[model samples]
Target chain A: MLAPLLAVLGACSQSDESITEQTKSAVTQTTTVTADGPPRLEDGSVNLGPPPGSMGFWTANNGRLVNDPNNYEAARREMNSRVNIEDAPLQPWTLALTNYRQDTFIASEPYTRCKPAGGPRQIMSPYGFEIVQMPEMERVYILTVSNAMSYRTIYMDGREHPAEILRPTYLGHSIGHWEGDTLVIDTVGFSERSWTNRDGLPTTDKLHLTERLTRSSLNDMDYTFTIDDPGAYTAPWTSGFGVEWNADQEVFEYMCQENNISPAAMVGEGRLSIIVP
Target chain B: MKKQYIQCRLITVTAVLAAFYAPYVLAHHPVSAKFDTTQSVTLTGRVTEVDWANPHTHIFMSVEDKSGAVKNWAIELESPIELEWGGWRPDTLAIGAVITVEGPLARNGTGQIWANSIIKEDGNSVFDLPDNILESQLGSRVEGPAPRWPDGHPRLGSEPGQSGYWSVPSQHSLVESGVSVAMDKHGILANIEDAASVAPFQDWARDLYVIRQQNFMKDDPLFLYCIPPGGPRMFQVPYGVQFLEQPIHQRVTVLMGGGNSNWRLIHLDGREQIGQVTGNDNNPLFFGRGLGRWEGDSFVVDSNGFNESFWFSNGGLPHTSQLHLIERFTRVDLNTLQYEVTIDDPGAYTREWKSAWTLLWVANKDLPDHYCQDNRP
Candidate 1:
């Protein structure tokens, strides 16, 4: 027993030495190419170009334009990790329509007249987004194409919610946890004010969504989302995909009002006349 | 045999080395180096703390830089609502608590740094668990507004004489003839579809709709039993709303009138979702659950997961757990916020529907301190 224990100890030391050596080699290799090129910026900042595109934001699929499919499962994974479209299949309906088609849909009578977007499909559309992360408060902020922004707090302290009834909203309330490297988010407290999609799919305030995001590779992530709202559907449904990281991108100030045609027409703008005939 | 042993040892060593370095390589990529990544600056300073509740929290500290110039650096933190849920008490970081802070420096040169970790002078870190604190301190400049709602907005529900007129436009299309209005400006209603329109039901939805219709025609026990109106309805009540802007921290505070009525804090910090539970069983009497973000000039809000103890709308629309709503309030003009709400609850309707209206921001007005306790109808 003593002999085997000694052998194990020797192996452990050997492993530690190897690790140290490998680290030294890595540092040496990395430093060898050091030509301190440009002076650092005053802000100590690096520009991250156009934000990495998510599969949901893809402009085309297999050389065809499409709408973002409600692939909740894939979205959950991609949101949590590095996003890459090449690794995952082009989800169904992802290329159903182009940005032009989406504009047309918004211009159509049902939507123009203030109809609900269809159920289970609205959240996945490719649009502008702002992703805000607050590590101190354990919260994440998401502003999507629909001009909806959600603030989700990650409960780092092991505390439960208080006892009482709640008011509801469109994006619902979300809480998240880190499972290994992946972040798992559970959302509920949805209001009846939102449809599942632009086509008017339905859901109740009981809507609950569980999303898992995992960075599968350096530049890509997998997102998986499961939706369960007993009041609307027969059963829970799952969907999702990959999102590619665009490191050199900043979340632009997405001002919907600057080019908003929806409100203009809804409040009786002349644009409706062009489409109505 | 000696050669074979050496080869085996090499392979073993290489594998172990790779295994040990894989995490470090993955963690220390260029992305990690971009945002003042590893260096931490700990600041020890006076409280100068401002409790600007939701969206984000702000604390300003007077720190002496390397040049010995005492500059007021602004530190942004999370809202009190989030902190409370995280077991943070009101006095956790008191007005006079000399604390240490750690965070990344700002991308813009404003002496401001995003706080990564905050420690008390007692050597106790405020948020050590969950690795919430990003770094420790080095004296750096902090900037941004200490959170405070701009004062002088009229309090909600303060108007004296004229009965308040709260109108919710009919959600049905003009083609659909039925028109229903709320019984009282403060009372509830849930308008079901015309009986002829209810179809394509898979039995359960049909039955639930029938029960809901019956509940609506009769006096809802929820209202009689003094149960609070649940989720989406809480905001629909036509009441004066007030806006509190904290420019320094880029946060907004919206105070509404109705029930005991609650306020919503919109954080302008460049932070996204942290995994905090969305719903609470307690505080159900308050605003159900609020998650808000800004998209350009509009503020979009999604709320739900309410106790079924309330009505769906003032028009008597009934709902089950499936009630999910998406609301968009776009300030089209300075005084008008185009409010659009889409209602989708399979338990209540055969198909999803939507409604559109405008919320006129009463400018130059003060929110009246209207308490629901005095008018317990």
Candidate 2:
């Protein structure tokens, strides 16, 4: 499998490729740490989270759940909990990835090229997103296991959004409702080439959003988000966190365009330079 | 009559926008980074060119090696609307028509073949059946009268000679109306030409299926991305499946027309396979982990985890996530259903092999919305 671990990691790292800022700050301090607690529910039904069929897997440290498989490094701190957005609120000649091309890879983020990382960069990656919950076709799907195998049906049956001449995708056009078990959603027709998350943030084609989600203890998930857009924000912003739930985590089929050498070695502006082929 | 209902609603909106700009409706790849699903090779010779098209369907052929050299290969298949709904016709491979192929090989060494089956010259394999019992030309179409359902099942469609005829609407229940070519699902319409019986691979899966078909199956993630069809290629695709049968909820819902508008949930309980009632920790599905029952009027089904990211067949043929599957369906009268499938997959293949086809009975119809990147093929 993987040729003797790439001949033992190609003989334990040949030229560490300029050490890319000490391996992304040592994989961003093992990716955001913070797992302590605050999400409780063991079938108590006292309300939220663990109740909606919780088996496991959710991040942003909402209530802790990398499900301890020898601590996959504590689910890389809720999938590297987004840090530098260079003070967002932008909208005055936008490009901002620390002020554009400031070290190449075209200021990264566009999922380094596998494309469509879309809104909240798929609720901030590490590959998790899956809500299902079909309440008899009122619809709720979601399904974002990494590069999102294109899902997010949502419609909740009340119907009322399809008009704007349709086509503007990359996970936009969602529409949910329910207020008791919480669930909100509301997305708008997006596709300004979709972006967000590691703040390589750009978005347009009027990208309005809403999200909400709720559930709190069986594993967690408080998720929030707001982000309206007068064309890439100058106002309307709010964000969110907490989504833990890991019952064993099954989305592994990363196929990120197989071995994308991320446009051949250029780790200064955003990242991706592993060349295993 | 109101201007003929606006000319039949403008011919049903011009046949639903000509099926979303139909250009062979696309997407479907994966030979594993170009071939090496445990390697493979067989080749026979002569068709020379087929193309066919729509997401995939190549052909080519030439073979000859051992030093005599003369390669030529190519192969591929599936699409041309799932090989014309399984019965195949576009002359059914004929330039010179010799055929044979086996599959895998490529990882750049290149002759080419994401193939896996094909033996024709009447030895029959594709839409097969030359043996496996052949007799009954219309006698007692299973005696007649069937339409049940108070949970007694039966009632599915097209059963004159027990629902397996096809002057045309294929997926192959039995065809031949003057070479419409079909009958392979163990119904054996062999027709004439020979050679097809391979499926025993595993030398490490024939060298990883030729390094994933010489490096172009690009690691094959659901054929480079239009993912959704779970085993028994979701009833041999020809896009027309619908069976809801809930039986109070023991579970049985299968509604796959192809990619983007999918639905598979078949848990009929007896539990030999079932998981993902709640998601997390990966249940690896592209239609595996099914589990149905009912054998008398026939329903069967089985499935397994499945997630090598696609290709149990379309000739990209690799398998590993262990790959199990049994399937069976049998409507046998009132518009036929038949099916069958086996493929045990000892990690890749060195044993188990069986395949069958047939579906018809579309009746009334209502499934449409395909999506595939809006028309990617």
TM-scores for candidates 1 onward, in order? 0.29, 0.26
> Which has the greatest TM-score?
1
Those runs of model 1 whose alpha carbons end farther than 4 Å from true positions after fitting are A1-125, A145-162, A259-264, A267-277, B1-377
Q: Count the backbone clashes (under 3 Å) in each candidate.
A: 162, 80
Q: How many Å off is the CA of B188 in candidate 2?
A: 38
lDDT: worst 10-residue window of model 1 chain A: A55-64
Q: Across residues A1-277, which tens digit of lDDT does each residue of candidate 1 receive?
A: 4565456446434532322343223222211222232111122221111222311121100110112343322222324222233222322333233233343333332322222222223234232232333332233444332221122233333334334323343445556766765667776766554445432344577778787655543344455676687766556666555544433222211111112224344445554211111
Q: Which has the greatest lDDT?
A: 2
Q: Rate the local accuracy (lDDT) of all candidates.
A: 0.38, 0.49
Model 2: how far is A213 from its true place, Å? 15
